[model samples]
Target chain A: MAPTFTTLGYLTAGLYTASLACYLRKLFAEGKWAGRAATLLLAAGLATHYFALLVRAYSIHSVPYQDLYGSTSLLAWFLVLTYLGLELIHGERAMGAFILPLVLLLLMLDFVATPHAAPAAPARGSVFALHVTSNILAYSAFTLSFVYSVVYLVQDRLLRGRRPIAIMWRLPPLEDLERMARSGVWVGLASLMVGIGFGMVVDRQVTGAMLQFDPKVVISFLILGFYVLYLTVSRSPAWRGARASVLCVVNYFAVVFSYTAVNLFFSRFHRFY
Target chain B: MSVYLLGVNHRTAGVALRERLHFSLEDGVRAGESLRRDGLVDEVVVLSTCNRSEVYSVVAQGAAQPEGGLERYFCSFHSIEPAQLNGCLYHRRDRDAVEHLYRVAAGLDSMLLGEAEILCQVRETYLAAQRAGLTGPILNRLFQAGLEVGKRVRAETRLGAQAMSVASAAMKLAEQIFGALKNNSAAVFGSGAMGAKAAQQLRSRGIGRLWVANRTPEHARELAARVGAQWAPWEKSAELLAQVDIVVTSVAGSEWSLTREALAAAMHARGNRRMFLIDLGVPRNIDPAAAGLYNVFLYGVDDLEEIVEQNRQARESEVPRAEAIVREHVEKFAAWQSGANAVAALADLRRKLRLQREIFTDAHREELAQFPAEERERILRLMDELVEDLLREPSERLMKDREVRERAVLLRDLFGLNAPDSSRRGGE
Candidate 1:
């Protein structure tokens, strides 16, 4: 018998996500550490999340991408990992202020999206691992970028208004914000490139492949295209601060549409998963 | 008596005008002497830096006598018209003069706020004037307070570090894009303070090719060559423009020396290599439009101010520590300056008692120390007690009151007492 991911799965993920969001809010609002206790709680949640994902994957003897429940669990894990990667790149523990709450929300949605798990079993096909990983990786990158864009927007607004966002003054300087936005976009672009490549590879192999002109795939490509344009504008047009922010926000929602609109609501092509 | 500070600064005058009015160290000593001989002032200290030429002095305690003596004296010293100096003059009396000195020393009255060296320069000039027997009790008290205030402003505010001087900031922007500037080439187009500072920066960063091209070629050529570069003659800058990496232009504000056409032509001639043009000149010697050229960076004072403002904001977060340092400096200065004033009262009381003793000795018709030993001891003890009693009040007043501190010069002047001069005979 495997140690199945319980409600703790959602709590662990949701707690970290919530903590990050609160920290970001505090950073912008007060420009100071709001709660070390909350930070510790989020760290604990991340640990528990790692354990849960590992246990479930071990019991199933696969990457845990078979049923909807496994997919939800994997999404939560990918989000946290993406967040930590972003933190490492930018030395921005503040993004966790926004990132962890999101992870927690997704974990809670895990409860709503997939209640009880079926008996432990290997994924239906090899492509299952490929499809699941690529989608979440790209989606997580998109999410992180959106966070950066939001901060950039807030900072930009404050600068223009000759005021401070109060909380954001604690985040980073304007240059640092610009650097963050650029870094986030770069990560997103890389993630989209890899995820799209893997999608094509797995589509050719998996039967009734999810990427068969599916709306999800279409939306994902659209999301990728948006960010590509974002990069272009940033480089050539010097689309800075505000303009980059808009692209980030729009791309984020495109990600949400790809995952939710094509998964739970329109599951025609992804029915195999 | 009002203190007066009338002078041309970097802002009000172009470099040529400023230089013409600027007094060298020798000129400064001579100017002080002339002011003394002409009875233009009772106490005079001339601050003739590149940015400003100020005369901090005490006038008769009334409206300037219309003999035009001070004006004539300055005219004779500079060999400039009284009318020409009139438009450049700003007359401040008493408190305003005191405030002006303090603010200048604090870098508040500077072209760039809170510059570090000006305060020390003011201190040095004040000390020199004192040594020259120019500064009396009033000037001494005023200058000491000003120096302390300077330290306070520099410490308590972001004025020192956050105030990115036009020269240094242009250097910083270059460093930002190029990383370390050790391998960079910086061209200085003016031989003024700002240009000199920029040159110093280039030298400090190990800049391999430094160019100091000024209208006055002789001014900074030695400096340029020492920094491992040849002096680019003012007219030859176009030929050499394509050769340098960074161009710092601070030529006279009215001149269009580093025009867009010239810099662009240089860029094109250099095969479109990246060049950073920093215009420290107020009127913008390098055209703002030049920044649009590919790989060309152009920035003026306003742009540098933007950086300063941003730095100031970040500095806001770090100000508490700086304020603490400033507060400590303020207290230290206040203590010493006030203590010096109090010591004057003690000296006065001691002098008066000694005078009385001399009178008694004459009546007794004995040697000074030959009075009955017991009587002499008693007299000395009475003198000590009287001086201490007199000093206690002034000391307590100085320690307890800001009003006294603010009016220290006037108070000292009124009492005909002085903080024993720091440089002369050891203070009592």
Candidate 2:
């Protein structure tokens, strides 16, 4: 069962790599076949990733996000799922080349870490579960926002350079990339706010204190502040486009720190097996 | 029998002379009917477009020379003198005629190489000639072959896949910027032909709102009504500038210009929303300096020309592939035509043999009267058997070998089988 889970995981990652290749092909070529191929491959990867997680949970007789490996795997799956939804909604796939690399990186981290059996941890209440779910959703949306922001900058640069290269035609226009990046931030901010509220409730119930000053908790709030400031300032006419895109890209750094360094190395209570 | 083409295209004639030769759909059908009715051609089809006017016809082997006749008739019909078309008229005969029509249908012969409009024009002209009863088996097969060539070229090559015109490039740029034109608005300055065309292109893309303004208010109103758009006062161009996502200016000799400062102010007023400006005017309508402003993309005639040149180069690379496809189809058409000609020649030979047998019996009728009626019938059956034996080898060779089939015309001439008949109308 464990080998089956590992095989499926590797297959999902391989499909994602292939899907990203297709998108990159589309970026430099004039054809719809590549775009269609990319979308189909990405969808297949998402389905396989979902099935792998389910298999792991079934074999362990517990939820999959009990440890850092399981949670990072869950984050990668959600990131792909969210990006797929965005592709479908917007009818755009050029962003896939910019996005699937982060997904692959997350999977690489999950696979390289020591494989562990299901943790025999204390039971988590409904509030703790909501906290984890919201945080994962927030992180997934922020990752997508980061991808959109980067694409926005690329598109902006191409437009500024005024070169009629094939890839410039493939990328979404500046206005569209800007709008998607902003929308992603709005959704992430809402999810993160709900996630923080749930975390506070769970923290009070578990440690009898609403505030723990854990590095992860402090960085999470800091990430929340950075995005809150981004959304507010981006709405202004003077700072709406390139400046806004730059801010979104910058804010993702704080999100990365909160999710990786603080949660993995510094947080005591937030530690997973 | 031969296929002949007579026409003047953009390559041979200037626009003034080309337009004179141009025919409306109705006029084309009439011209075809008149030519056929005059016994100039056994079958005829006329193709008239903005760039060229062509008369494609299948004529009897020794029919009246249609090239000179068509040239005179074209000039007379358009109330011009024959001398006016002396250097402009071009004539193609036989296989050359067939290949020319294929090239035209495939858009290789168009002014703008690989334009899609030529294919549709060719189709519509063929159908109209068909409807007018002016096309017979030869002309029918020729036009059908031409249409097949068009479809194959489009399918096998990317010749007509890109935007190769200024208006089309503008629309492509708009799509890139707005992602979807359905939610974007655009304004057109000046009611000139280019501006009107761009406005129509935008509307056809389902642009959210379209505003038309010109120096002449009534002209603006009329153009707006034509495209089902709103007409704004020319003075209010600045206000419209702040609202629309796109601006196309083709106002000729206009003193007014959208300066960098004014456009910057508009960008500020519109919350820094991106704006695309296309200046199609010759002397330049919009300020070139405005292109440097953030969120403002301004393209003049030169920039649009650059895009068109890029597309043209891309299309040019596919020309060899397109020509290869056309050459393949042309060969297929030639083979089918060869088989048809061979069948006709064989039929003509059979008819001539039967006629000779009848003449011999008539001349010897009295002497044969001495025989019984059954014996006479047997003699006729023997003649028929000899004719069949003589034709069997020729029939097999003609149908089975392309080289032999192509000589059907020479065979007809060698056997003195050149009497005027439908078989004489077979394509050579």
Model 2 Cα lDDT, one tens digit per residue, B11-130: 999999888788999999998888878777888888999999999988776456777788778887899988888788889997889899999988999887888999899999999999
Give the candidate number with the greatest lDDT. 2
Give candidate 2 misplaced runs (Cα > 4 Å). Answer: A4-49, A52-77, A93-134, A161-166, A191-213, A258-264, A267-273, B1-3, B37-42, B59-87, B93-98, B136-318, B324-328, B331-428
* Interface CA RMSD of each prediction in angstroms: 8.7, 2.5
RMSD to the hidden true structure, all candidates = 12.7, 5.9
* Candidate 1 CAPRI assessment class: incorrect
* lDDT agreement of model 1 with the native: 0.65
Worst 10 residues of 1 chain B by lDDT: B419-428
> Per-residue error at B235 for model 1, in Å?
5.9
lDDT of 1 by residue, B361-409 (tens): 5686555467778987787678667766866776677668766744554
TM-score of each: 0.46, 0.74
Model 2 DockQ class? acceptable
Using alpha carbons, what is the TM-score of model 2? 0.74
Shift in Å, residue B244, candidate 2: 6.5
Best by DockQ: 2
True contacts kept of 1: 0.00
TM, chain A, every candidate: 0.78, 0.91
B330 in model 2: Cα distance from truth in Å? 3.6
